[model samples]
Every structure is written in structure tokens, then in C-alpha cells.
Target: MPSVRTILALIASSVTVLGGALAEPTVALPATACTTGAPMTTAGYPIPYYAQATPSTGAFENGYQPEPRWAGQHLVGTYTFGVPSPVETGFAYAQFKCQYYCLNQSEGGSFFVRADSKVGSYCECYDDLMDPETFVNNNQTLIGAWNAICKEA
Candidate 1:
């Protein structure tokens, strides 16, 4: 017969295994669009916004804070920049179908904004750090769309 110590050990091990199985499952965030090295699905899709070779990590993807216009805009996203350690600084454009539009913290980082035209043929890019990003329809079209989409909010 097993001693008390042996019985206790068996019970403890069983609890540990059962606990893990009973624990709630975790959900995964959506993948980032326009990754630097990933191959494009087709000639024009996925688009290449920016790419850097570093240990950069992004937070969990979430819905846009202020929200955006358009029905297909990404509702989940994560920012990839922060203070203390700065990354690259430059401007690039891509027509990506992002799951969420990333936001740049005020401290510093590569902040980007996107606005798609109604025709779906053109997309406007903006730099969160500055107001010098490319503009289409003199910003009216994008602003109107955003307002219209976020109106219910």
C-alpha cells in the first residue's frame, strides 16, 4: 500500500494537471499588416509601409481609441514605439488592409495614420508626430469620413 506521503504527492500532481486544463483559454491578437520581410499575397495587396530589423515588439491589438471612418477599417491594433529607446525615423507609405491602425504615443515613435478614399483606389497617410503627411481632398474627404463613421460614438 502507498504511504500517506505518496498519496499526497499523487493528489498534488493531479490537481496541478487538472488546474491547467480547467483554466480559461487565452485569445490571440491579429497579426500586423505590411510586415517588412513577409512576401506579399499578390502584386498590390498587403502593401509595404515600413520595415526594420530589430527586436521591436507591439502591444496587444485593440480597437482604435477615437475610432475611424469606413466600414472595413481595423478595429484592433497595437502601437510599436515608446520612450527611452527610439526606433527609426522616416516616412513611407503602403496600402495595407490592417486589422487595426496603430497609434503613436506622444513620447516618440513611428506614428502613422491612414485615410482611404471612397473610391477605394487612394489612401492618405499621416504622421502622428507631425501634420506633414500626405493629404487627399485637402483633408476634407478624410475628415468627413471619419466624422461620419464616428458620429454614433
Candidate 2:
């Protein structure tokens, strides 16, 4: 004995609930994963959406390379080590370009890197809301390292 609109509303509510249950959760990273209070600059505009180190082997999206230099082409730095939301940045860059921009570009992804002494690092690149300035402000250690290492190079 319900109105048609009421019945439609109930159906929509059920669908929403089911959808919420099926949707994947966003990636969350520890504050410690990123360096705190380190200064970072976009001095090199078009910061290479590629890693300086070799890209590890995995089910990566297209256009990723393990080595920075290959066949007279050098992949630039997509991110500085220990940056907040590197994973998120990677994901956004991938979607924006339709290609993989960093290692482990998936949510809940992890990888081993030379930096952090080869410790396993998690991918935190899911959020598209972060801007470059805000990212720099949030990740001090990463910026400091980039300035010292990448900028100097």
C-alpha cells in the first residue's frame, strides 16, 4: 500500500547500501611514511612522473621503466622519497595520463625501495584532492631529500 515514489525511494536506498558494501576503501598511510618538516620545491617543473631508481618488476601499468635511463631516454622523478600521499599522487597521475606513473600504483599496494634502506613502503596515492603546495607542506623529509639529492643532480 505504498506510493510509487516511496517504493522507488526504498529501492534506491537498498542499492546505495549494497553499493557501499561493495566499494573498496580508500588507502590510508601513516604520517611516519612521509618525512615531516622537510622543504620541497617544484624547481624542476614537470617533475618526472617516473622514479629515478629502476622500476621494480610487477603488474605495472604501461610506460613504466625499471631504470631511469634507457635507449637514450631518462625517466625523471615522479616523486621524492617519503612524500605524503605518493600513492595518491601516482594514482591521479596515472588516471590523468592513462599510464602508470609510479611503483605499486594501486590502493593497498606495497613495494621495497633502496631508500628507507630497502624497507617495504606502502602506496598511499588515492586522493586527488591534494595540491602540489599542500603536498610539499605535508612532506618535509621528502622535500629535503629531493633538494639535496635530485636538485643537486
**Best-performing candidate as measured by lDDT:** 2
What residue pairs clash in candidate 2, if any at all? 37-140, 38-140, 38-141, 48-78, 54-66, 55-66, 87-125, 88-124, 88-125, 88-126
Best by TM-score: 1
Cα miss at 36, model 2 (Å)?
A: 12
Assess each prediction's global lDDT (C-alpha) against the native: 0.28, 0.29
lDDT of candidate 1 over 81-145, digit per residue (tens): 12111111111122232212432211111223333332221222222211122112232221111
Note each model's CA RMSD in angstroms. 16.3, 17.5
Whole-model alpha-carbon lDDT for candidate 1: 0.28
Reference-based TM-score, model 2: 0.19
Model 1 alpha-carbon miss at residue 22, Å: 1.6
Which pairs, if any, clash in model 1?
Answer: 62-76, 62-77
Cα lDDT tens digits for candidate 2, 1-153: 999999999999999999988968888854322211222223322323322222233323332312222212322223324323454453333232311333234321112122222322222232121212222111112111111112221
